[model samples]
Target: MSADLVLDGLDKRFPGSPTPALRGFSLTVAAGTCTAVLGPSGSGKSTLLRVIAGLEEPDAGEVRIDGTDVAGVAAEHRGVGMVFQRSLLFPHLTILDNVAFSDRVSGMNRRAARSRAGEYLEMVQLQGFGDRRVGELSGGQEQRVAIARALAAEPAVLLLDEPFSALDPALRSDMHDLLDSVRQAVSPTIVLVTHDRDEAARASDRIALLEHGVLLHEGTVLDAYRRPQNVRASQIMGGRNAVPGVVRDGSHHSALGAVPVPLDTPTGSGTLVIRQEDVAVLDGGVGPADTGSIAGVVESVRVTGARSEIAVRCGDALLHAEAPPTQRCQLGDRIRLMLPTTAVHIVAD
Candidate 1:
């Protein structure tokens, strides 16, 4: 049966450090869903994972798995499977023995453990490779074996800690696909910790951004991208082109120009976040008036496969725009650009 997981007011503080690794962080995962924890390094992503897996005890908080408090349970008794970045398989043991280690610890006979391990190996699509040494497999293959070993235990929840970091880019994408397939087949509640934005966008049904041990925002991918909670969240979510602006008269007036933005809050001064794709190119040497388009010259153009990204200089601000690959424009070409009214988000102070 699938079970939901909850973290209620979790906090952790290392000795001799003024700041806590985690501070009243709380999250809930619906059964059979994947929740990705994303943050910069030292943001306590790994600490939170360890706390959930019973490796670290929070100074003052509780962890509940499937509606039961697992605070007092030992790591092995918690029935939480963890796959780490490094495949810590025994070098001398065959892949089969590595997968069966947990079964043996659970009092299964050697023959039974071997049989169970065989089934798990097949599940990870490495059936015949069970007899091979762990050192003999490629990076991706070894990772698959690690996943098989973790799944062989049949834990209630699975925790992944940047498990595909060692693989190459192409192989990493393939592993992501394999992870989706496995999740759908098993329907297990998964909590993945990662620093890769693309990986979080690709694998997670819901994404949570953590900063300095605090959860800044958590929601659907589009929700986070569309409506970031603060300037930090907006920048971390990859809206790099931010402009200082003032919201008045149902529009935001910034260095670029005026754009329609919701003025719900009391606006003295705020930041306007614009996605690169939302900016369109205009051909002209003349600039638009106030409440008009911003004028800039193409500083550089980058051809990235299907689309071409253009960098424009509006006074001192660098505005990024994406255009069709077929549209060819040379450097030093002056152009007027507009930010989509729907895409411009006013970041509250």
Candidate 2:
């Protein structure tokens, strides 16, 4: 069965390093849910996962599983399974034996272990590939076998460390679907470490963004994307439009003029953040003096596949917006943009 995982004030530092790998980092993941740990390289993403799996002991803090502290538990005794970016399957062993290695090591008979392995293979949609050697399968299939092997151990929690980062986009998507099916079948508590924002959004119920060994934001995927708490969080989540402004009398005053803000917003210097898709591009006929509208000249237009990225210059601020590919706009064309008050978020500078 699945279990709740909690990291309380975890701190880890390497010798001779100026900064700690993780400092006072804490998060609680509910049972049977997936939480993606997202960060750039050297942001301590792997260190966090290692601490959770009992591979690296924390310098301070508690690692709890189902309300019980496991501070001194050995890696093999921690009831955690991990899959890495590389498959690391034994080349000499058959696919079935690789998956059944853990069970066989635990003293189960070979027949029984292979039988159990077959079941997990079917779960990952590799039912008939058991007889094939590890060298014969494709890269994606090798990763599938790796997953089945980890699952066959039946650990309470599973930790994945960017397992699909090496695969092509199409193959990566297939693995995501396979993970969904596996979750439905066994419901293991999962913590996925990834640097890709879109992967985290697609695979996990919640996202925990980390930077410089510190927790930046932790919430649902939508919350991290739409309701970031600060400028750093906004930038990490791919926010492009950040207009310098000051909050006064329930309005934010900037180059775009005074836009209404939430009544509870404190009056102070802040930055106005809005997602690209939220900025609506309209014809120049729309009056610039309208309540939530501003006039700008198109500075750049880049069509990428199905959507287009538009850059508009209004006064001193350049705002990036997204529009349908069919919505043609040329450089220097005058346009009106509607910045709905609800979509405009004010964040601390």
Among the numbered candidates, top TM-score falls to 2
Identify the candidate with maximal lDDT: 2
C-alpha RMSD by candidate, in order: 2.6, 1.5
Estimate, for each residue in 1-349, the C-alpha lDDT of model 1 and write its tens digit: 3578899999999999989999999999888888899889999999999999999999988899999999889999987999999999999899999999999989999999999999888877888997899879999999998988888888788999999987899989988988888787778788999998788889889989999999999898876676777778767877767878888887777766666775464466888877787787764444564344778878999999998999988886788888888777669988878776777787776
How close to the true structure is residue 264 of candidate 2, measured as C-alpha lDDT? 73
Residue-by-residue lDDT tens digits, candidate 2, 217-307: 9999998888788778778888898989999988999998888886777789999989998898875444555667888889999999999
Worst 10 residues of 2 by lDDT: 283-292
lDDT of candidates 1 onward, in order: 0.85, 0.92
Off by over 4 Å in 1: 262-269, 283-292, 300-306, 315-317
Superposed by TM-score, candidate 2 places the C-alpha of residue 42 at a distance from the truth, in angstroms, of 1.0
Q: Which pairs in model 1 have colliding backbones?
A: none
Model 2 CA RMSD to the hidden true structure, in angstroms: 1.5
